[model samples]
Target: MYFTSALVSRSLIKNAGIIFSKQPVPKNLYATRLFGTSLQKQAEAFIPKQRIKSLLPTNNSFRQAVTRFCSKAAEPAKGQKAVGWWLVGCSGMVFVAVVLGGVTRLTESGLSMSHWKLLGEKPPTTKEDWIREFEYYKQFPEFKLKNAEMTLEEFKFIFWMEYGHRMWGRCIGAFYAIPAAYFWSRGYFNKSMKIKVGIFGTLIGLQGLMGWYMVKSGLEDRFQDPNDVPRVSQYRLAAHLSFALGLYILFLMSAFDHLMPTKQHAIEITQKALKLRKYAHISKGMIFLTAISGAFVAGLDAGLVYNSFPMFADRWIPSDLWAISPAIKNVTENPTTVQFNHRILGTSTLALISGMWMLSRKCKLPPRAHTAATAVVIMGWMQVVLGISTLLTYVPTHLAASHQSGSLILLSMAVWLTHELKYLKKLPK
Candidate 1:
């Protein structure tokens, strides 16, 4: 019985050890799993979705990565956006050139050259050449009629004035053109930007032609009135001034766009709120028209006619207001009428801008729009003061030029205000 019990215990111990002991894995089962896992991973990662690259036109996993439809506007390298600053320099040079042009006109120096020639081919370098140029001027109607008593030295002074004006203009063209081409080649502009700058450059060329065209009118005998002083046509002068102002606005807009591209997308007004924009546009139009009329005033030497403002020579409206025939002629050809119209236009511009500013307050405006509105009102008032001072000072060259520049500044403010309002989202009251 004891022997049988000991055998039973040994058998139980053997079974427990077999159950706990480790066994070797099958070679085929282990290899199958390792190979299958390796294959599965390769399939998951390398499967190209063979038709996807050409079919959907894009990878679904990266919808925002590549825009295939349209080009995105690019911002130039940070702190490397010197192109805008360069454009601003061009704008500033134009400002001085305009003022200098005004001085050239005010001094009666515009007719001195009598001919336009490049500095290289035929600029007068010697005293004898200058004397010969002056002698040539004596044959013109202006020298014969207006300055018959004028001497050669006096002619030289005026010649230098006009020559300086032309030289400055050439410099402006060089400054604006060369850099524009350089930036364009460097891929600084996208397709849309290329079109915009193209237009701007074309206008610059047009302005150059217009300058020559304006001089051409003075060089010819427009009307056979020997009694009339030889001056450029008021119409041509107005056209020139208007073109210059338009060019100025364009440059300023382009510079602003580059410098503050982020602000352009800041606001978008709904149709319901567009009236604020219209009023701003109207004010801008009025300011532009007033500037044009002032050009007529300068052309007719009308400022000299009515030396006193608020009243014209002891009369509210001068008796000679309709000095020219056909009544329509009175606007540009009539000195008295031109001055009267300038005054009216000036006052209307001031009133209209003030009204616009007040109306803007009635509506909720974005912060930028609000600031622009305030500037418009302030600039408008300052312009009025400048105009009155210019008139009261009898159109001194300094005062008149300031008034002209002030008009430009005021117009810019109006345009900017309009732009701000056009894109402006209305805030909640």
Candidate 2:
């Protein structure tokens, strides 16, 4: 029912070879009574008639059974293409969800609602509901320190940002599970592929739990003073971002497998080109690590701590890179160290991306891979520029958010490049 094209093609070729070969016939057929005739008629029937007899199988019954088996094996199924495309669409939606998550972080709306109410009901819409929700937030440290005087309108601003992000996550869950169930029920997915999707789905569910876990860190009195601003642990933030990216990469790879499976184009490309694609996945892994470091930078508000660029406060490494009294305090608790590490990771990402682009220039890569690499290079440069501007401008909210969004774009491009390289060429121009 789910035969691969290669399998069908092989079966057809084998059957065709068998059909083209001549089969032996019994000599006794010529001795039948109908064959008795004049000399010319006897000779005419003897030669070509014997050849026709040689072509037929000794037993037509056995030949018929073999033919039926070969025919069934070679016939194509109608649903294969539909199943592949459905997986691609589902992955693309998950990628969109990742982007929205970045927006939520950029706007500082990740921890807006201090409570994690799973299945509490959809967000409140009525006037009375809004007031009750706003009242709950007022009890948090963020409201006291940063938004002490924030108006109802301002509260709505942050509320919508977080709500939209949460809603998108819910939509992704339904989109993935419902279609997956439908496809699985139809027996469209292969055994190995189904296992992969299951693991991916599990990670997605875990990511939701991680989100709530991350938020819970900042909801309580982590700070001694009531006036202090509470923030999620940088470690948890890094874990959240890293897991999201992991899901993105997995979905991206699965989508690539559907769009242009390696088995489909396995022989088209040269060995060198194929090897380059393998290396690209390694590049993606490095970028993912850099992105997590970036989260650690953001969670500690590292971007705001040091305004200078190319150097931290006109120094290569600040005097007190680990100045915090406790040893572990500097990595996540200290803003300066976090910003320093972020700058280092940002620089490293730019360098590695540049290296990838340069390597691509000398190789014979597909259009999708080429385009993705170029886009990553371009966006990496833009993000660097934006990062410098953000630092020099003291991390203005708008510019900082744009820089954050730019990172998402760059990450998407990197993920796309790895996928395309693994799959093969895009459509011919």
Candidate 3:
């Protein structure tokens, strides 16, 4: 009788289990019943259906639903803000570096170091050390051809200038790398941001190498003739400047992405906003091209060619604009042609930016974007004035450095405007 009773109880328990299993027990049924819905269902309501499907498990949906809530949410808001500020600081460092570079070039101090060191050199300290460094510089073509009469004290001045520039560049690397490693380890960057950070670090490294390569050009034996100025190659100079600009843009745009995320706009305003966006993009391209042309001008000392504005050598066009062989060479290799090209690019950039500003008046832009547009136009005018003033003053170190900085400032404004416009939602008209 006891055995039968035990068997009956076991059979009843097995049947109960079978019934419960066959009834399709919901995953997290306890929580679902308590909350009136599964967590996955709640997640589906807030998250995009397709994204949830992609991230959640087909077999065990509730197991990792919270884990895959939102990839963006992985980064804390505070961390993102900190990263944005960090990028802005990096951008400022690049700005200072560019200005210092311009000063180094203007002061004819770029080639004074004579040697390139990856980690950096120990700057001369003692009198004998200074003399030895000066002697080392004398061995280079720049000293042999141009600064032969430079005294030890004068040598110290130029050496310090180049040293400071190099040191600042090294600082930029440290500033970027340490923070990047921290942010990355702390999971501040999303996948896309990680790729951007990687690219930025790579560019910074290349920039350092390019700077050395440019200086090496001035120290080479290519300046065979006594009359040849011991200066870096125009091509190399332009490339170096372009690389810096590219790196600056990356830093700046990435900062904007973190600091100022896009906001959705109404469909009614889409058409006008789209049109303005196109103009802003074009204006940005023009600004970038103009700044690059200025690099060529600096590379060739083209600003010293014609110290007048709206005219080249007292004429609308210089007779020797195309003096270099193979007309294409004249564009970059010919000083006269380079200056003229820069003038045209600058004026056209100003005009294009002004036109875009006027167009902005017709369309309704986001407040920040409108501010950026205004800043671009104002900066455009200021840059043109600075360029003219620099040329008029025979490229005085102060004025010339400011002119170079102005180009970057103008570019920054254009970048800001374009970035703001890019993030705006565009709906079909």
Candidate 4:
């Protein structure tokens, strides 16, 4: 009986130990999930988690991480700084070159060099080459009649102007190429950007070819103005100027693309902006047409021919409007007609752009974009003023050159505004 009772007690002790091992104490259970419970308690303590109203860009590290993630979602990436800066520099050089080219054209220095040399043949490195080049110029009608008594030194002066212009163009090409190559080699280029830059380079090269083409026109004999010192064809000059401005805008757009400081997705905003851009295209077309007319005004020396205000030679429309046979001929040769069209185009463009500016006020836009649009409006008005002054003053070399500069500024502003309004931020993954 005692042995049986001791065995029963041992069995009971063993069962008690097994039960305690399976079920931990209350305090021990709380400790096991203490961190998770604390987190839940904190979350539940707030009446509304979102309504805590933390300051923007919260001080807490966790909040900062959340905010950064949200920001990243909105704006994928900003434009690469290094690439943007490089493009800006290149664009600036191109702008200066355009201004200089305008000066060269206004001063009639474009035709001073009657020869085209790709390489090898130098620009009068020796006295012999100088004399030879001078002799070549003497054969042209300009030397025979207009500049008959021009000395070798005087010839060299004009020669240098043309030489400098061509050299500047070469410099532009080099500037574009070296940096472009470096960036591309370093994996900076994407497929679309590569195509864009390639197109720009090709256009620049073609512009050089067109420059020679323009100069060649003046060097060759003319059927219409047989006795005149032939100047470049107005049509060709317009084409050249158009291409140059195109190149400038392209570079500007690319620069803006690279310098975009934010990668914010505004797809809906961008679609609306694109709709506005279509209207902007009309403004672009008007601006371009006005510019071409200005070129025609320059080409025929039209501004110099008609210096009067509100009238051309004692009449609103010059008596020689249809002087050329078949009437179509008057458009190019008749200085009065070309100047008349230029005035019409210029005034029309000014009116159209002003109206567009007013219409732009109806749309809501980002603050930076609004500023750009306003700038475009102001620049347009300034350009109109410059145009009037240029015409009233008979396109003086200085003012005419300044007017050209103003036009470029106006174009740039218009482009920037267009870009800003149409801007679509890249999305983050």
Predicted model with the maximum lDDT: 3
Per-model TM-score on C-alpha atoms: 0.77, 0.75, 0.82, 0.77
- Model 3 ranges off by over 4 Å: 1-78
lDDT of each: 0.73, 0.70, 0.82, 0.71
Over 4 Å off in model 2, which ranges? 1-81, 263-279, 365-372, 420-429
Q: Output the better candidate (3/4) by TM-score.
A: 3
What residue pairs clash in candidate 3, if any at all?
none
Full-model lDDT, candidate 2: 0.70
| Candidate 1: worst-modelled 10 consecutive residues by lDDT | 62-71
* Model 4 alpha-carbon drift over 4 Å, by segment: 1-59, 62-79, 119-121, 125-129, 223-226, 261-277, 423-429
Summarize candidate 3's per-residue lDDT along 1-429 as a digit string, tens digits: 444443453344334434544443333322332233444565443344555554444554433333233222223444989999999999999999999999998898899898888998998779889888888888888888888888888888898999999999999999999999999999888889889999999999999999999988888888989999989988898899889999998899988988987666553565667788888888888888887888888888888987887777578989998787799999988999998888898898888889889988888777888899999999999999998898988999989998989989988998898888876765665
How large is the C-alpha RMSD of every model relative to the true structure? Answer: 17.1, 10.5, 9.4, 13.3
lDDT tens digits by residue: candidate 4, 1-429: 434543453343234334534432223222232222222232223223453342122344443333232222223233356677877777787788778777888877787787787641367888998988888888876666567788999888788877888888888888899988988887777788889879989998888898889888887756235467567888888888888888888888778877754344354453445455566777777877787778888888888776777677688878778887888978777788898888888778788777777766766566676677678778888887887788788788889988888888877777777667554543343
| Top-scoring candidate (TM-score) | 3
- Backbone clashes, candidate 3: 0
Higher-ranked by lDDT: 2 or 3: 3
